[model samples]
Target: MHSPGAIQPAELWRLFMRAMAVVDYARPLELLHVPAADIPAGHAWIRVLACGVCFSDVKIARGQMPFSSSLRLPHIPGHEICGEVLEAPGGFWFQKGDRVLVYNYWGCGRCPMCRIGQENLCLNLQGWVGFTNPGGFQEGLAVPPERLLPLPPGISPEQAAPIGCAIATAYRAVVTRAAVRPGELVGVIGVGGIGLHAVQIARAAGARVIAVDIDPRKLELARVFGAVAVLPEEAEETARRWGDGIGLDAVIETVGHVHTVDLAIRMIRRGGRLIGVGYRLGDMASIHTPRWVLEEITLMGSRYALRHEVEQAIRLVAEGLVRPVIDEVLPLESANEALERLERGQAIGRLVLQVGSFSGV
Candidate 1:
């Protein structure tokens, strides 16, 4: 294999699957052939191995996500990418055949947030791959070298792919943002991809975990992921069962619905924290302002993982402290089915698309 730093041809064609339109509900993504020369500058060429299908992708494909208007059509909709470095610009450190995972956040590096190592919250944001920019639903990826994280040994590309977003986002919410500590009771709402990982990360942080979801299968999987208590979506009933009608220490809400937000707030104890990681468009929830002030509850929103947080999340997976839960592995052509599963909330942990075969680390 040629090294990523080795320069060769300027024009190469690659086969890729991409969402051709947002209006078509029957089929949103399809395969296409595009020239390598069309890839944006300052990006390394990577052979995409696997990409995880996130609920955000489903929303984007359906034209339901916030800022969905910014997406250019014929777009590829996958952000959690695992790939092998095929080529890199001069001075780039990655080499050919090196396994790596793409960090979904791409930011203007000169901003204060980027300077502080929080590129995911960049003030002058460029756009997230798979959302605003070209993503890894295709056979290859053009990624900024700085956005690539090395794939740890013993973790296959398929396993590490979901870590790019699902695990990384959960770790940031539970470990970095929430700062969950030992003996604290942490509640995870909606045990889907990110929520399931949140339960594991909270448990690994030594916090007692309580997970709530409408699906019984997901709740059962949450128990397997180390959640001490699992409950249905009835927040009132859940609150009654835990802490003797008091509340929880922290609640991570992954399903961004009006009622879920209300439920999260209702189940929090005084001086507790609620971190929101989900986004629902055109939906509003009301909170009792007086109660919020009196109870001293902190409501915060967490986006994707920071660069350092993504690295930390990867290390946790490498050490076996956390594992990526994959509900199904499908081919690139099965992207529609994967998205449909996510839209229906049928996937337990994550649905990954194996875009291309990898030789392993």
Candidate 2:
């Protein structure tokens, strides 16, 4: 949120797009210039068009991606990617030149979760695009053929990437954690990429959405996306003023800050539900259990979306229920710059690396 708008904030969008990859010296993404690889049987690679930037990418660039990894130096940092298939190993469901959206999480197919068709939370996922494996901030990508989903006609690649990550994550948190219902009221905290989508999808599910964000600009964006009204840390006063209120029917906490979490807890009605969606680091925030027990509050943790859930997100985009907000996209040449923007809270929606673009069937 711009402070009063009378003051123009510094760098509404960052100018740098540089990154020191895990495998290479800090370099401009364009200068590094990696080549696309051929697809071998049972493997698939994509020619990346647009890849949405993510908070986790910021962590990985700073050595934050989890697991004991032998990350190739010069690793590309992007996960929310959308494009057409360049090559597909046999037995895969795709073909060359089909518009597609990628599922970011990678899991082994034999695991129970995968066996039941949930691979996004894979137990033995080798590596996700932009984390351990080569990602989409390049001209193309090589992925497990099964992880790619064919997109409905007319869905732009730029729009697809955000849904793959931001939209899917929010959708999963609401459906799996919040268990939202029609006509219920939803109090959503942190109205950025994930937060904004939580509002739209909750509204799509028939819930009246009330958005909370520190920035007035972001809250304005939330209102544009159909939020009933934006709460600028002023909902506490509003709630008290509206005497008929019983807090919120559901609260989705996308902010990891301790104070924000406490506020989210206080905003929900008794018998409410809260989902923690942010990928937080360090010590966990202290949550008092007595209030949760006495009020019968429900809390759940949602990771990435599974296959079916991801499909649902794609459909939401196709139907125009939600739209991805892209602040800036660098050419992988600006990885460090992108991450820095994330660190400084200067980016909106998901920042992306425009690795390369192509046109074909």
Candidate 3:
């Protein structure tokens, strides 16, 4: 790989972590060299410094998640990204040598959702950065200039990458979807990467956060994130006690399993809301309709964040209101190991991959 200063003519190397067929586990990501001329117009070339590995990456690698068939073989998988600008088209705002974080969602600009600042829910959705498009697994990527957000000072690229997805998703769940208010009791299920952030964001929103997770360590970590209570086991019993034996005001379900969804349903108050940010493909949860209607339960599915939400999440991290809980930082060569650790339910927070050199930029 060439150094950031050591410039070649116009080509960049990338890891093509593709799976030709369904497998039990995630395979190693392969490397490839993409020519500059091959990149489409209106996109800026960026030198990736760090990219965070998400749990959804594991599901996609195992062929469990439903992806578009249009995506060809040898696909590169990584959404959470922080990089430095290398090249941009004329008249673009971003110049070379700018430190920036790539926004994961790339929606069609003309869509009503995009025009209304809800690009994450664009009616004509194109795809996400790492899922449908070539992602930050590579040393370099070509992204739209509008999708790049300026990285604030004092935050490293590794810390900023996961903000693009993990923290941003949590922000949407707690702040936007759930609309957590002051003095409300919020339950954060699954104290993983997204859940941990949800814990802090809920706390920041003045809600009493009760964290529920099977992992003891994550439950403890949740306390550090300002969770008022922790429930390692008997989530229903503990949540009832925390909510005065009734239920919580809102529940952020990050695990995305049938059980977690069901638990969130049982843990919410009569007029409570359940915001789902996790992806459990092909899994179905049974909800009692009579109770759901009688209780005025609100079930909302929050995808990634919009452009404005990305900026808001970054500001929270910048101001020290919310911290990115990173478990491990590894080189790009250790991508497979990182994915395996995340898949085994061992990661407490986010796992980041240091792809390229973070030099002067």
- In order, what lDDT does every prediction score? 0.82, 0.72, 0.82
- Least well predicted 10-residue stretch by lDDT in candidate 1: 11-20
Tens digits of lDDT, candidate 3, 173-210 = 99999999999999999989999999999999999988
TM-score of 2: 0.85
**Model 2 lDDT per residue over 1-361, tens place:** 1133432343211122232355533433333444334444576756677878777776676665554155666676677888778567777679888878787777878988678776766778766777777676666556777788878887777778788889999999887668899987787888877888888899889987778887777788888877755565687554434324677778788887777778777777778887888746663665688977998988777887887788999998888887777787666667668777877877777776665455565
* Alpha-carbon deviation at 202 in model 2, angstroms: 1.2
Which residue pairs come into collision in candidate 1?
4-88, 4-96
Q: Each candidate: RMSD to true structure?
A: 3.4, 9.7, 3.6
> Going through the candidates in order, what is the number of backbone clashes in each?
2, 18, 1
Model 1, range 329-350, lDDT digits (tens) per residue?
A: 9988788899888878788899
- What is the Cα-based lDDT of residue 58 in candidate 2? 67
Instruction: Name the regions of candidate 3 deviating beyond 4 angstroms.
Output: 1-27, 33-37, 68-70
